[model samples]
Target: MRTIAEIKESIEADFMRNETAAKLYGFTSGDSFAAFFGKLSVESVLFYLFAVAAWTLENMFESFRSEVNASIDKMKPHRPKWYRDMVLAYMKDRTLIPDTDEYDTADMTDEEITAARVVKHAVADESDDASLLTIKVAGEQGGRRCPLDAQTESQLKAYIAEIKDAGVRTALVNIAPDRFNCELDIYFDPMLLASAVESTCREAIQNYIENLPFNGEYTNMALVDQLQKIDGVRIPELRSATTVAAGESVVTAIDARCVPAAGYFEMGDVKLNMKVYNG
Candidate 1:
């Protein structure tokens, strides 16, 4: 990663340190040689040559390093992130050539299957069963994450089975977003109308929930902090927060932080109790 200028400077320093070369070139000191190299005349052949050599060497070194790193990555065993990436890269209706484990790319273009893939967001984690991976996936619909349709889910499951490593099992979780409900107590500036403040605060809450990373943790303190940043809000308190996992009806309280079981969450029932701030 050394810049061309740095490499050139290093080469000049090494050349100047050689007393024999300096004496042969009739240069008495390091400053004299540096002055000659710093000139822009056509006679400064060594200076330009060193610059060219350094640039070429730096590029070669970088290319070699990249090739080595790529080789190492290929040799590494499959991990959680790799599984997530594979799931996202899955193309529907693609036939895997038997024993090769690679898709039949003959007469097929990438654009053909791009629209067939329904899974847009994915997260992979280890399951309770040994050698088993749990992958949660969701598709985008109207700018929101949603579960894949029955047909698409079945196609994805079959694809995973074919490409997964031997003896490794994968559990696909394609479900609706978990439901988030909360009640907040907000004391706001009287100058701003209650309705306006309430509207802005509700937007902030919705944004915070929707923007969380796939399977990201949700914390009560973080939500309160987000509300406190809004204008015209003096105090923000989270009265209660609960979530119902997708496909389940029981509500569970979030003590500190909770990760959505379905890989993401949506706003369910939010109640903002806006009150005027009295000093």
Candidate 2:
């Protein structure tokens, strides 16, 4: 199997890494953080700074891809309107470009096809569950402890029901990770550490749910006082990440999954808010 670094490189190369695309999906902005950042109130000056940073980086990448596509079409000889049309097409498809000399791929043969199929099955162990909520509450005391409460369970059930309208199934998978760090003094600095921890746990819990086998892999989770908020913690990962299907070829419906999630909760004079999603 390829090493983690190799897997990361393979993904990068698959996208035809230009510096712009690299920055657009930079390492610092992990998938989880990118999702949370987007839902922030950009109207606030503090949050607006992030909005500018993300947007500026975004435009830079788009401009670079546009120029590359434009050049590729101009250099190749094709129908009068072909160059103009194909550039847009090429921009949308990451596999081809004016700069890719070795992009030439030969037709697949029986042996190559068989080998590909084998590789797929080798790494095919994964799962299915619709909705998962990992709620961590702040406790006046700090050990890893909290059990499902009636009010908490009902609140999350309502949240899950709302999402059911979207044709998405959600099953709450509760995990009790080591509770909040009370001594860390969340009040000292806006609960940045708590927020970060909250982000990580939410992601971990969701991932655990998605990989769980359907028969009976999960039970509802709950906690107290670590994140003292009544509504629990929230962190949204994406906004409208999926394109609605229209059943038309030219419409070119995007098939990628967009999971935008948010986690919210509060602790000692501070609140934890985070999101995770990739478009």
Candidate 3:
């Protein structure tokens, strides 16, 4: 959208280019409308009116462009990202109004529906079949990602069934966070107590794991780098790292980077072996 200043400048440029209009308006070729006409003059007043009209036109053009883009989005087929958005938008215990996908807002307030939306983080990806989509979602509980309650999970599944495109299958994944276990060797300065440093290091490690983006990658090197940032630590080494997916018994060693099967991860057994560094 053109700004009011830009519109006014364009008008002045056009007025200056027209010799006939400049002569009739008593404006010199080298002088702009603002330079030739006083603020309260008739010419200045008319020029301001033109600028306002052009500004209005620019706004209308922008509005029209936005409407066109929205229409295009509505017509496009639903993709994985769109499914993720739909999952996050699910409201618990709300029934869709007949013949429409939207809930009855008149019966329930917007704030109520918003509060009912429990899913905080979600990711959707295509399964082996192109027509099938796997969606992972979690709600925020105690400031960490967690699975929804049984009742809420049922409601969310029903909502997905109703809104999903025909011939497309959606599998919902709302489970406990994957467990991450790691052993770290920390070399700390002699000034700080090893116990205090160990406590802070554990907190730092928990924060780093819980704060990773949902469905984000976890790397051994990244954890080492995070541990090295703590004060009184000279060298931080990751001895071993392993993860067990939620509801699974098999553990997988993390060589470099591993994306959690569950959308997020929780702290498991973290062993901090602290050693005093004299050098």
Candidate 4:
């Protein structure tokens, strides 16, 4: 970047140097207006030139820096292994998913694609020579959580393909829904019932648990605190939250946490019994 002193020197050397411009000013050479202290008009003109030159140089540097930064971002690697950032950006592109704006990606494994909202991993065969890259998305379709049917998945695949390199290939696999049964015994203020606070608390807790990231840890204390945030719930408690996973009834204790193996959490039976108690 050019300094203010350098710009000022350059402007002073070239200011009003043309034949017509110099003749009209009655100036044979710029050396006559060297001393700015006595000549107020010359001093003001020089100051204005310096200001203009400084402004121009500053803007030039800013533009240059912006261009360099943009170039660096574009130069970033978009290889198959470096898939998170590129895939996330592609998923958020409005052109790719014009119908939906609520979905977001979460976890990702070496072999499987894990996301908070929707996505699935296809089983890879180690014996095969070729590799299969599969991604299944499920989200708000017709006001319900369902797989990104053939048409939507195809549209997303087209966009993803365009972003990938020429030799790379990706496959779209069908994702299965992972459901968890939750039973909540909540305590709240009955006075807030007029505002439907009880029902609101139940729904809020259910949504929070259901929408947690795929394979993300779920804590019991977090659920209780989130429930208490509802307007009508003064003191919210998560009485018992148990899930039937792999033919086992796994209970999430007050201090415990659990994560689903795949897919996002599904609300099985969120039984909320609100009690009026303020402690």
Number of clashing pairs per prediction, in order? 0, 33, 0, 0
Tell me model 4's lDDT, rounded to 2 decimals. Answer: 0.55
- Model 4 TM-score (2 dp): 0.48
Q: Which order, best to worst by TM-score?
A: 3, 1, 4, 2
Q: State which candidate has the highest TM-score.
A: 3
The residue-by-residue lDDT of candidate 1 on 168-242, one tens digit each, is 778899988999999999999999999999999999999999889999999999999999999999999899999
Candidate 1 has its poorest 10 consecutive residues by lDDT at 36-45
Compose the digit string of candidate 4's lDDT tens values, residues 1-279: 666656655665565454665676666556534642343576556666776778787989899999998788556634343343344444422342344322333344433333222322222111144454444344554444545656556666776666654455566444444455555666666666633875686578668766776435777878877887877667665667765443345644324677653344666666666576666
The weakest ten consecutive residues by lDDT in model 3 span 99-108
- lDDT order, best first, reads 3, 1, 4, 2
TM for candidate 3 is 0.88
Comparison by TM-score, 2 against 4, better one: 4
Question: lDDT of model 4 at residue 253?
Answer: 36
Lowest lDDT block of 10, candidate 4: 118-127
Candidate 2 has what TM-score?
0.17
TM-score against truth, every candidate? 0.80, 0.17, 0.88, 0.48
Model 1 pairs in collision: none
**Candidate 3 residue spans exceeding 4 A from truth:** 3-6, 13-32, 106-111
